[model samples]
Target: KRRLEDGEDVLISGFGKFCVKEKKVRKGRNPSTGEVMMLDKRRVVTFKCSGKLKKKINGK
Candidate 1:
């Protein structure tokens, strides 16, 4: 949790990898109003499953 808060990647050998990515400020649109707006830069966490985990999930 601390590492994630610090924007660091965390890996679990047989499970998956958690990546901390930096997103730049960019333009976005509001679906309802169709108005353009600027989004603030922020950190996002993404996860990628390991091959072992994927295989298990697929019942391999």
Candidate 2:
């Protein structure tokens, strides 16, 4: 949210508010009951790499 507000898309690996998203809902199965269930959408934190970081990893 901060990043978006700042008009920045790049983010580091460890810490930042931009490294998150609202996960979408989907169908899933319960392991214990072997029954189908609807999974609710929720916000989740995630990590994404910048182009510079990707280049460094590939170069190595």
Considering every candidate listed, which one attains the maximal TM-score? 1
Count of clashing residue pairs in every prediction:
0, 0
Deviation in Å, model 1, residue 51 alpha carbon = 0.9
TM-score of predicted structure 2: 0.54
- Where does candidate 2 stray beyond 4 Å? 1-10, 13-18
- Cα lDDT tens digits, model 2, 1-60, are 666545455455543335446679999999999999999997665666666667787895
Candidate 1 lDDT by residue in tens digits, 2-59: 9999988999999999999999999999999999999999999999999999999999
Question: Where does candidate 1 have its weakest 10-residue lDDT segment?
Answer: 1-10
- For residue 43, model 1's alpha carbon misses the true position, in angstroms, by 0.7
List lDDT for all candidates, in order.
Answer: 0.97, 0.66
